[model samples]
Target: MPVYRPSEGCIHIDALSCLRNTGITIYNSAEPRRDSLEVSVRTSRPSCQLIERIESILYSVFQVCWLEPEQTAGKVKPFFYTQGQAVLNRSFFPCADTPSVKITYSATIKVPHGLVAVMSASQWHEPSADGEFRFTMDKPIPSYLIALAIGDLESAEIGPRCDILIMPPSFPFGGMENPCLTFVTPCLLAGDHSLVDVLIHEISHSWFGNLVTNADWGEFWLNEGFTMYAQRRITTMIFGHAYMCLEAATGRALLRQHIDTTGEEHPLNKLRVKIEPGVDPDDTYNETPYEKGFCFVSYLAHLVGDQKRFDDFLKAYVEKFKFQSVVAEDMLNFYLGYFPELKQQDVANKPGLEFEHWLNVPGWPRFLPDLSPGDELMKPANDLANLWSSPEVDLEKVKQIDISLWKTYQTVYFLDRLLEKSPLPSGNMVLLEKTYPKVSKTKNSELRLRWTQIIGKQKYTLPIYRALWASSETARKLALSTFQDTKKQLHINVQNYVSKILM
Candidate 1:
């Protein structure tokens, strides 16, 4: 197909081939005297190969698949979706795949009568009566963020200006940020709303990542770090400061794990990294960008004396960079320009607070947020854990501590501490389980995962197997790690069940 850019005096010939999905070449042509130019070329649909497929079904990157029937046990129905990160969007259309290019798009999609088609644009909750759906995104976004999904879908309101899009069971990612339509896995329907944090994370991306994007993949922390910080802010608003801190602590742990595994010298550990030509951007993907970026942003907030001042600055930053792509230097320059005091050489020279040191230097940042507030809120849970860990402490006194007022995060913190030690004696495990039966029965995914970890370490085969089978896809790696270690102790039938579920 010929895509003519009369203004640029160029025509792009996009072609479909057997080996490669699509390829394009731009040729200089005489500028059109009229407002538009038209050209005709042989056109064929590109059959994009799936970058990765899970469960002998669901395809990642860009492709179509079939989802198992919702009501029928063995029946399957066609479900089409697109994941266009990196250069995958070019498979759909010939366009600049880099994040630096942003565009506003409008599309009209037609599907079967009963099916609904949605895109990362202004969309209707319900499909049109004629089965024709039209969408427009006034805000400019990179091509990778331009996604489409069509299926037997349903929606329900979660909050003001927020609704959940329930995709087929074959949906792999726990959730994807596709503007108004945030596609989520069916596993989130765990009875309890513990998985809604994923929703908050996606919503925050609307502002931090979608509105103000990183110029390229190398500055990915710009997209992730800001969104994570915003997600925490929203979580704190809804669930209180203590819950937010607990989540932040969990993220910090993940960041440290990535640093250790990937090594402190890895370029990906730095807040701002450089991507060499011909290198795939996905290789550098890790929690370092999300968590480490968050730490640096959080450090800046604290450095400016208070979160409110930092928050005001964030509002201004978003306003300044809305609908635009930026690099780390753009953000740093904005920070210095916004706060004249920060521009002083003396202020910039402070250890760990320097712009270049924080953004360019590898390893963990010298500055870390003081989580003393979280420690204070979690003192009760910590005290209970300490009592249980003490050799001379009375178990009865520990059992008597009132934990009814404790949040889910407090319970998770207590359980996490328990896992840090070697497995407890069987009798102690029994007593602990009996005292806090809710830990085993609770539907909260976070607490359940932590409780399962403790149980798995103690070699409590039954609970470990159950947790493995019930775990969310997002936690599959963690669940599998626990299962691998304890699988030998479990019954053959239980082992088979876990293998089937995870697979």
Candidate 2:
């Protein structure tokens, strides 16, 4: 497989040439039988010259191809298939190559008996014993939007805004929330309300990602960030304001991971793929799109105070690009169109830099945190930026300050700032443990939940877990319900910690 490098001029011509020369490359994708796949797709290439070019590009990316269709006993075959778009690339035609070119796709998949097949759009036909299923996606989508999954699956059907489909045996992340079949993971069977939460998120994508798509991978936030934000709104709609808080807190925690990894200097707007010496649009995936994008959009929602206006903005966005391609600039222009006030925001001060620093740059940007303090407000920011620069900074002063102050003020953001400075001081850890119990006495549910997240992640403090367990059932229910309701995501670490108390 040759290295992928998009040349400067005539991108279509270069891409076609690469596709013709490169063919397909498939490796063991954790599941061997489902590993190799290639398709010689026929497209509207103007000339043979263009056809040859397209072949080269495909070969480079997909050199190894396989047609095996079953999860053989004792062998880990590709356990699932969401080849909706992948099929177009491997079996039919390299199509909807870019969001700039939206193409309607119809797929015919042949598989063994007792296997279930699904796609991004609604199911076109029912299962048959002849080992074949035909599915058509009326909604034009980029090649990536197509999904194909095959497994020992049973689907549960229900209707709300759309028919809810669940495949309870597979712990697959999100399911197809199509008009007919909505695929879900086995976890939804936990009977938790988060199932509906996940379903609404995916269904909303049909309008955001499946409809109006991002033209370039450089603008994934336009795809992922918007979807995440939409999902949060759906959660809020179904569950209420508390759910939004949970989503926000969960998103913040995830974003912190990205920021800690990349550092504060990198703005969320600049996330991009890392390339080799010569690689075209390097395709590495990062949480920046999902996490940073959500954070920034949430911040925008914060800036635009009213829900009605914010919703109208989204509805307008969907209506404008119902079945078209969109770019980051298009979205920025859209926001500026509806909310003229946004146009006045200082671009320099605006908090959308992750993609700006990473994607638009040649190398990893230097994100050294400048903990050397100036003003009090900037101190925490400086401290956070410095943690990644020098991994050995002591966080004693930040931690020793009264937990009661942090608790009273509900300084989860402050705690987050300190935690962002990773490898925190030993004294801080001791201080945190000492102050852990005091949270139980406080009436502030937010403070308690924040403490649970922090302590839950550190050392799996059995003492705190036991305290939570020994507390009244009403308190436990209150904590969980409150955490679920708002942008305050209960620390997942607490789940494991709480589980230990049960054990």
Off by over 4 Å in 1: 1-9, 12-66, 70-78, 123-130, 157-160, 187-192, 387-394, 457-503
Q: After superposition, how far is residue 162 of candidate 2 from its true place, in Å?
A: 4.0
Q: Return the TM-score for candidate 2, rounded to 2 decimals.
A: 0.53
Query: Which ten residues in a row are the worst by lDDT in model 2?
Result: 26-35
List model 1 lDDT by residue over 202-237, tens digit each: 888888878898888888899889999999998889
User: 384, model 1: CA deviation in Å?
Assistant: 3.0
Model 2 per-residue lDDT at 197: 56
Please, what is the whole-model Cα lDDT of each candidate in the order they appear? 0.70, 0.51
Top candidate on lDDT is 1
Model 2: lDDT to the true structure:
0.51
lDDT of 2 by residue, 83-139 (tens): 232223433234434446666667776787766666555546876788788888776
- Per-residue lDDT value at 456 in model 1: 58
